[model samples]
Target: MICIHLGSATAKNLIEIAGAQTTVCLRIALAGLLAMLIWRPSLRIDPRAVPGIVALGAAIAGMNLCFYAAIEHIPLGMAVTIEFLGPLCVALLTSWRPSNLILAATAGVGVLLLTDSAGTASWTGIGFALLSGLGWAGYIVFGKAVARHTATNDALALALGLGTLVTVPVLLTRAEDLPLDPWFLIGAVAVAVLTSLVPHAIELNALRRMEVSTFGVMMSMGPAVAALAGLLLLGETLRPVQWLGIAAVVGASAGATLLADRHTPAAPETPGEHQPIRPTPSEAVPVP
Candidate 1:
């Protein structure tokens, strides 16, 4: 949670100069490089998995682009609170209980409070955030699809690389805006590490030791964490109502995840290999 917020704060600090496109391109590009170097995934992957990889890569690429663009137009906390609807939707879709509908309604009210559309919030930004949420949902679906065909790390590395490729045209247009100063370049690299490389490494390790359901529930705290990051790191304060809205979303996420877990059966552990669960895009953001 902390690392995810830190990465978000770091990107917000850079977006003024780098712009959303450049920031996302560099971050994912660097992440792809790091993953390739570390995993050295087979260059000759099975052909059957290409479509899943492409879809997952597109999801990651689209998610980051929309999400960064969203924060560019809206407050960090509000944007994240809205973007979290993706995973929340996934959690709800997994179960058909009446409680899930209540949870969904709670999240909707929370979003309404956060948007307060009649006031200063930009509907355009909200739209982008919603699109990002959709991208996030696609990410989880395609990630699982790809995992069914290949090793997790290899698929992820390839996805990162392919995502970077998908963003290349946009990156080209913004390439001239990329910082040339040594310190600024360093800051960009640091953001990449903080946002992508570090989180990927840590999440990969953590998944080996934790259950997916537990991780999902913990991830439900993302909105609160992002709100704190906005307050502390970005010096952006939320109104009391906004805070309540955030709480509602977080509570809904945790509740939905727990309920889904209770209703679903756990997969048996593999006999010998210590296989980690495939990560959702949200889950990829390291907690600390």
Candidate 2:
């Protein structure tokens, strides 16, 4: 999930140039446009899939907006660490294996250590991050349902479009100050592609291949990835404890994924067809 982390890093840069709400709105709009252009999904959608698509769209909008807001008041690593709780919760609830529970506790400890290293954090940021985490959990749940009931690309594209629509009122308030210079536009587009389009594209495909619990456990690496990106791109430094925290998360994720693989039940393949019982390592995260 380097792409997701990279998206987080680039989002920091974009938020500096524009307000959090505006940046998020623009990013989703551009990504939606790109998805629609490429996929050209039919206008009509199955009635059964409507609620899932709408919830998925709303969750994406909420997640991005809350995440951007959280980062405004806290360090990227800290925000991501807190926001990760949503997916970690998902992993635990979906799979109640002793190993998964242990790993979730391990991740919790790592998050506590990571946050401690960030010094005094704003409670507002913490709240926002928690809400973002909730949104993320919803995104995964509804996303899985959407992917199951509809064409993957079409569902995602439509959801993004709906997200953009939901954010329009907020975007309008800042329209007068929105950057329009050629150079700024170029950067905005780049940010939109990296932060919105790429990760969603990779993840939409990945969700179809792996179980949601497996996906969440793998995505638990996002904070570590964010920490590394912060160091390289933003010149942020991690403390010894924070380093240990990253290690804890990484180790737990690896162990859980491998454990899940060994115990995963095989499903029968269709006639004349063969599908891998478990997803590959790279397929687990879908980084490009």
Candidate 3:
């Protein structure tokens, strides 16, 4: 929803509003504040985890940078279609259910139709979007491990801290583009709230109570959400083929979730175990 609104507003005031690089830098700043307030990590450092944290931070920065760049060159919808591959890959690697295979195919068809639309988006934009997706996938894997090793709050704070450090040089290079208008700053804050803070909080809360596979299946609805957001907020209408593609991905995702629920086993009694039980080959678990 924030992305939709931001995109619309930016479209109107591209010159007045900060570009993607500046907006993302503000997002990092806001995220850093939120994480610090929530996590309040100790000054004590873990040397072993620093490399992983740094890598995750770089990936996050790269994903945002590339995504913004892609949007500048292509339609917002198409850019998102390409970026969706990141989470899709994460979901695929973590689960091998036959139903999920169908889900994957469905999403693939949707992406194909979405990108093949009238805009004739450049291969460079698509390539950048793909790179962003890969970065997102990396972010998820590393983030999960970090969360496991430390508190979610602490891990996120540390990750953001690292991200800030990594992004400073880029931010410096783009400093001249930083918006001086108070409204632009406000808009940046709004974007951070919607895109960074809200989504992260919601996903973290949801993941705590649900399985990763289940989360992935649910996230398959993102394109539909983005489309709706585009329509309602940006007055960007989708064509019939695009609508069909959205249905395919959404349907497959829902189907996968249902199938997984049927196959998951009852919980074991290890009360102290940090992680949830891994679903068996034939087992599926419902979102709690």
Candidate 4:
């Protein structure tokens, strides 16, 4: 929400400002610092896991970059709704429960309503949003693989490191557009806090106390949250139809999660480990 408002308030071109190249660099740098300060991943090298970690970082970077780009061209609410397809896809892909099909269909209809409005809709932007969703799905799959081989703290740090390395080239190419003004720096920090650090910290803490299905159900409210943020921060009002669509998507996501929780077996507890149960088939793990 902050990013959308800031980007719009500025005279910059949204595509150039929020494209795959720029956001990747910024997120990599910001998240890398946060993860390193918080986790301090061991310097030890795991030769076998390096490739997977690199791929995971790349996917994470791609997801952030693409989603920011999509939002550059669409309302934050609409962008979030479309981008949410990634996790929804992950949920449906892993589950075979017949009941989830209805939830999936409902989400699909909501997305259609979100993107089909004549005057406000941009097909190109919607295309970018879909692409962002695919990237997010990729991020979750690869991130889970990385998490399996290392601690979340270490894995996230490494992923950010790799992402930063991957994004350096693009950052250099766009150096001229980089903001150096003190106020812009302040705004960027605010964006980092609102979109990245705070959410990551809160969610990570929450995940320690919750199940994957429960977490999924909770996170399904993100679009609605974003909508609320948009209303408060940007004075963006949703039409009745759009509000209905938002409700449908939120309801379906929550319903699917609840159903998954009821039917899925509880995760096994490890002996001597006091850590909370981690959700399987992780969702977007939002960076922005």
User: Which candidate ranks first by lDDT, i.e. highest?
Assistant: 2
All candidates: CA RMSD (Å): 4.5, 4.5, 7.1, 5.8
Q: Over the stretch 1-288, how does candidate 3's per-residue lDDT look in tens digits?
A: 344334433532442366666667767776676556645666564565566667767777787778777766666666677888887877777876766666776787877776556465687778887887888777776665554444444555677777677666777888888857787766665555556544554454344444565566566666676666667655777788898878877887777667767876644332112533223211243211
Worst 10 residues of 3 by lDDT: 279-288
**Model 1 stretches astray by more than 4 angstroms:** 44-47, 97-104, 198-219, 256-265, 269-287
Which regions of candidate 2 are displaced past 4 Å?
265-288
Instruction: Please provide TM-scores, in order, for all candidate models, with all chains considered together.
Output: 0.81, 0.88, 0.80, 0.76
The candidate with the higher TM-score, 2 or 3, is: 2
- Residue 156 in model 4: lDDT: 59
Tell how far residue 184 is off in model 3, in angstroms.
Answer: 1.0
Question: In lDDT terms, how accurate is model 4?
Answer: 0.59
| lDDT measured at residue 277 in model 4 versus the true structure, 0 to 100 | 25
TM-score sort, best first: 2, 1, 3, 4
Once fitted onto the true fold, the runs of candidate 3 whose alpha carbons sit more than 4 angstroms away are 1-16, 43-51, 205-213, 265-288
Q: After superposition, how far is residue 47 of candidate 2 from its true place, in Å?
A: 1.8
TM-score of 2: 0.88
Q: Give the per-residue lDDT digits (tens) of candidate 1, residues 1-288.
A: 577678889898788887887887878877777667666676676677799888877888788889999999888888887887786677567535577667776776676666543268787888998898899778766665665556667777888888767666777877788888787766666666666655654553434333343343445566777888999999988888877877886887677667766865555443212544345344567445
Clashes of each: 1, 0, 6, 1
**Candidate 4, run of 10 with poorest lDDT:** 275-284
> What is candidate 1's local distance difference test score?
0.70
